[model samples]
Target: MPVAEPPAQPPTTRTTPISPSTPASPVRAAVVGTGGIVTGSHLPALRELHGRVRLVAAVDTDPARLTAFRDLAGDDVHGYGDLDEMLAAERPDLVLLGTPPALHAVQATAALRAGAWVLCEKPLCLSLAEYDAIAAAEGTEEGGTGGPYASVVFQHRYGSGAVHARELLRSGELGRPLVAHCQTTWYRDRAYYSVPWRGRWATEGGGPTMGHGIHQMDLLLHLLGDWTEVRAMAGRLVHDVESEDVSTALVQFADGTMATVVNSVLSPDEVSRIRIDCADATVELTHLYGHSNDDWAYTPAVHARDDERRTAHWRTPAADVPSSHAAQLDGFLDAMEKGVRPPGSGTEARRTLEFLAALYKSAFTGRPVGAGEIGPDDPYYHAMHGNHPDWAPKEQ
Candidate 1:
């Protein structure tokens, strides 16, 4: 994988005029931290929103990266080196926090406090403390007449296939889930970890687990509901880093369901897969490089439910599930417009982050770390303060 460093300072502002064909009321969204994934994943997704979302401003430490964003976003896309300054100046309807996972809490809190609806990138945060802090900053009750909104970016959950899968589970088509399996495999070359923050404990956080596995884990938690406990192990088997390059966990959900997850950055080819075993049958969904629930295969010993009723419940067509990022983005805007709750709020994001933190604690202490074990006072809470808990290095 090729890793390029972001440039420094804000570039010239740019804007592309909205036409009559565009949405009647466009939501102005400012993007903070236009480096790495922000450029690759977020920018493309934002573009797909068409007129509903306008790129009004951007904040980043790198000037060249800001210029690149401006070039693609348009002339009206204001650039700022300081996030607070940009928020005060542009006063965008929404703010997208594209910084590293470790910084998610602070950035998200600031954005919300500044009265801009925020859409934070995935993993919610890197540590449990960060999760708690963000959660504490949230206001679920109508935001007190006029207040900033908040939503996390778990695009995979918003997909048509994922939604359909959830409906099937709810409909008892798969019975009660007894087990689940998740695999998140991708290759990250040495060059990919060459960035200043990459593979570092103080900045990038964990390697594959936090950086890549989080997406799959988010899906797992969403599908399985709450977890009771987890036993896990992690090791830096391939990548040169302070964090694990490969990790696995044994997760037990509150419903007495069990699951196993394997996340790695050493696989030659990328694959994201999940399998759920219910009492009456099994439902499996698999895809490489992305998620598509329409391709899922539901194998039941027999169609326990009425065929007509099951068919009628299918909300998504058989076609490929579109990008969940777009749906998630639209969801946030809708929440803002309707004065209701966003689909992926910071409080919801806290659960996933807490789960990840517990996994780390369990792996390090060689004991099961329950949900409440990691709280605001723990030293490793809120992203381990960008520290790598003591772990033995693999033998050379």
Candidate 2:
């Protein structure tokens, strides 16, 4: 498909499935990662849900971090050094996968098989086959009875501007989307990479694209739909670790829309932005410093209709939304009650994992990777062969 310029305004928007004010019933939950993000994002979001959810237990390899959560949450909170032991005893309704990227698939599959709902952090897994396994293992039904639901963390979609943007697309106000450009640049100091798994391909997956840019990718796919092919290049240009610090990709979606994805972990300052061009108009938003709550710029494209005519156009207004992580969990709880699929089911996350796998394949073989080409029966299934991304020294 030929690539065309994005429309001068935002694409039409779509609304999320969850309701805003409906109170949720408390669901027993277990958290696995005691890392910074768990505190900065997920844990705080969970806390906000309050009576709707319970912090039954938490697990971490580090005894100190485990104790920290135990103290903050209170003494009755069960603390375990191992997830397996915790699952066996706690028997919680949910498990939060906060561990490194590589451990996500293995840990999530185990939790699902044990009949516990799962909320795994982004960049779901390192390989397509692993993603397939997670999808296959999801749900507790007859043919595949007694499994738990799984969802990947994509909180940005629940942001106010993002929700408004999606609503516009669904309302048919922006016309058809034809193009999207995404840029994700974040600064990472030596201290940041000091963690054992930060930049390693074996553990953290690839650098910024998988780690930092994953959210952007999710937003892009969520708005513009699936990609059919991708051509990308990745290299290590900063930090000292096993994965590339910068990467870029050319993406072609099934609807014939095209995109450019630029990501890096070497910037002195951070920025996340997406520019979408649609048949009706163009729209762009710049998010400086990664937080969606504030510090984001939204520019609607100028249209042929001026002043009065444009004013008559159905204007999509931005409204506040909860953290995407919380929204996802809330959706899961609702689904469990209604017996419906969650907003982001395990199958849905498989699309993102497929994109990641294709990305690595494209980067490694110096070729374009097509969607669905890496099937379950492919020899690369379960394949984990990429070299540790060079986290030190500049290279392209």
List the candidates' TM-scores in order. 0.86, 0.84
lDDT of all the models against the reference?
A: 0.72, 0.71
lDDT of 1 by residue, 288-360 (tens): 6566656566766466445655544444456565645777787676666655567766445667777777777
**lDDT, candidate 2, 41-95, per-residue tens:** 6787678776667787788888888788677776767778777777777666778
Runs off by more than 4 Å, candidate 2: 1-25, 140-147, 289-303, 307-318, 376-396
Please state every model's RMSD to the true fold in angstroms. Answer: 5.8, 10.9
For model 1, the superposed segments whose C-alpha errors exceed 4 Å read 1-22, 143-147, 302-316, 384-388
Angstrom error of the Cα, residue 149, model 1: value is 3.5
Task: Determine which window of 10 residues in candidate 2 has minimal summed lDDT.
Answer: 11-20
Report the number of the highest-TM-score candidate.
Answer: 1
